[model samples]
Target: MDKSAQTRRNRRQSATFFTLGLIFIVGLVVMLSNVYQLDGLTDTVHDRHAIRQNTRLRSLQQFQAAGGRGVVGEARTRSVCIFARDGPAILHVKAVFERLGYDIRATKDDDWDVLWSLKSPYVAFGERLSKLKPHQKVNHWPGLGSVTSKSDLATSKLLSAPVGYRLPKETDAFRAATKANPDKMWVVKSGTHRGVRVRKQVDNVLKIRHDANLFIQEFISNPFLIDGRKFDIGVYTVITSIDPLRVYTYEEEILLRFCSLPYHPFDEAEVNKYVVTADYTPTWEIPSLVEAYNNFQYSHKQALNLHLGRQGHNPKPMWQAISDSIREVMHAKEDGIREIVRKRFSHQNFFELVRFDFIIDEKLKVYLLEVNMSPNLSSGHFAPNKWLYEQIVYNTLKLVGLASATAAHPADVSKDERDMLVSLRDIQVASDRCASAECDDNCKPDICQLCQLCRTPYFTDSVKAAFLEHVNRGNYRRVIPKPLEEQPSTVDVSKAINSTQNNHLMTMWFRGKCEHDKTWCT
Candidate 1:
């Protein structure tokens, strides 16, 4: 009886152990399956997330490539190389680029989207310009001396500039002109010496070294005064293209420099009475402008406009005349600019910023005095000018596509979003024009050559560049290629024979665009 009981107990113990093992194995299998399922779910989420991220990046790239019209996403940080030495003059430029989220590279670094040099780099860094990618930009044009050079400008005979003659070369002419009008006050200016000396007597004119690079011109005796102080207006001008010759002037505010001394009593000896040197009087110091500028916080242009308006002078006509004069001067010097641009590998890589100084007569007539290349951007002389100079740089960069309000995009992104000038041969409109009854595919006739069908790639690219500029220009106003409706009555189209064929075409294109959409005019 004891042997049977022991065998039964052993069987019961074995059966219990076997049941426990089976339950433990089942629980382990279920747990492993749940873990695998969780891992698979995470993998799916990761794949979905990657797909979404890639799609977004692709869309952003496409948007940027298509001229950056809409909202932007995360963009690769671009680099700016300030080629000039670090100084107060370029501090605002660097700060603005930094504010726009650009990586400021050392001056020695060649890998940069922008190269901002203090002077024209055509002679020094020209080889770099040839190797520049479409996205690269340099802040200077090649032959800017044509207008900036005092001697060249004086000899240009531009209607806007005062009557002048070059020294040594035109010495006889200058002597005869001064002799003809002995009573008229003449001034002698040289490239090396920025200051001018009024010469009432011919002896002072003869004293000037004949070999020196000098210019002599009739001085504006009756200068328009504010509180008996003489002043000159400095208009910031930007030239974006040379082939079609696009010119823009900062319309927001102009740099107003007033003489420290009074203009009355006819003091030829006191240079401060006639010239606006670096230490010239500030707008805050001028009685008539101080109230509007200091108290009311009015801009220099606004305060000047107000003062002029109150004195029975409308600033609109004066500004328009100034704009016209700018256009005429550019037109007069277009050939020289084009000649220099023709030698460049890519003209699109270069742009220019200059200051056009003009003096106003008592009758509100504007006269172009001189053009300053690499004009001072520093506000060390006047603290209030910091804002104005910074804004000018920001706007100029925006206008030239160096900086953007939104995410940074390639500076060379074609703004021809409408593709108006893109691949004329592939466009249906261009195709139709080529196949017109009066035209052949070759477009042999001059009239047919001007059509889109036969337009050269250079002209097409120039038009595209111009259209892009027009889109990006914020406060800058286009002065050249004036719209037909807005053209002053004094401008004679027939007399503008020096204008290039491309310029004429651009004028027509802009005129047509403005007619169809008034926004293009602006």
Candidate 2:
């Protein structure tokens, strides 16, 4: 080979090597730019995700602050405090604690996990449900509500009770009634219609009013009869929440309290029979079969059925009528109830027991005669044999949780499933709730047996919105005020209460008042 040919070959090889090196450098720069763009996109997405998580966490924080039990786990604390003294209502609740193995005491202890307020309000952290020694109100009527006082009657006006007037704290009831209506057959009661005395004479009204709260209402003469006997029924309701007053009436567990005497109004001998009470026993010296049947130690339902069928009227539909009345009365006072309870505690964990006494007329129309706050829950009245008040204790005990559920969000739980409020009947679905949890020896049982339930979501956007949403769900019936729509003739608030007017107001008392236009709670 010649020298010139060798030099040309070297040049060609160098040129080819230079071209390859430039291409490699250009490709490396393009790859680095792509990598930088990818990182920038990832950071944008991560920052947005972080913002969303923080927003959700803030929302959850607000919900937990308002009386909501957030993120309640399966295990419940076994200890509780009985924030009540020795009484039928307190004693009955204590019995339930004893049976359930909950460490219950007359006074609350720091180590105790749950606070049983009985017929009272819930005490918050560092406070007590009952302080010092046990205190008992001789008269549960003051706060529990009464049928005998003017203020109470006004509050109960929402209940749409029979047209009645109160004698004030100690005003002559008989005189007042006689003064109100000289010709009407008004029944005067010290506290309730049961303890009432009906007379055409207008004497001694002042003494009765001075003795206690007095009320005078034209007597419900046409009461449903069981073989011509007058009787009243007892209903049990539980208050799970107060601010958003959530009440549940026991449909299955109820009692029928029958009057010992037959329904004979004018006869002085049978007038006592016209009055029904739990402790009343017939003058067994002339004890009739109904009295014998009542005294013979019968099952609650049996006694009720006998009393109900003695007159041969189906108790089922009659019961539905009674339920409507009870619900109507409670619905009327829901806001007031919330206000009353909120004055003490707004925590959703609060609960209470209320007893309602009702009497039904011959037309199957029910009248809400009276209400008992922390009513007589003596086992002897219907216990060991009757399940009316006992079940109220049972279900309430079953629902109240001792463990404080820590409120958590995606920031804490990393996108966990939402917590839920469940009913005892729906406890069978416990497995689904604990699917993510370590369902070991202890956790599985309570996952079903004990779950908190309320009207609103355990989680919500704002505390106020969530809390208000809670009360709205407490509606016994969503009586949406539709002024523009057709109105039901039976639900007139302004009209004087008459048997012909269905004897009830289906909406809140202030609603449906046609001071001008005949409609109103939109």
Clashing pairs in 2: 224-361, 227-311
TM-score of each: 0.85, 0.53
Candidate 2, residues 395-489, lDDT tens digits: the string is 54443332113333212322222233322232222334444344432333333222222112321211222223223332121222222233342
Which parts of model 2 have CA positions greater than 4 angstroms off? Answer: 1-77, 84-92, 106-111, 117-155, 168-183, 192-195, 202-212, 265-271, 281-317, 340-344, 381-388, 399-522
What number of backbone clashes does candidate 2 have, counting pairs of residues 3 or more apart or in separate chains? Answer: 2
Give the per-residue lDDT of model 1 (tens digit) for 300-410: 999999999999998888888788877877888878878977876678888889999999999998889889888998887788999998899889988887766444456
Q: lDDT score, residue 195, model 1? A: 62
Error of 2 at 143 (Å): 6.5
> Model 1, stretches more than 4 Å misplaced?
1-5, 24-75, 193-195, 405-452, 487-494
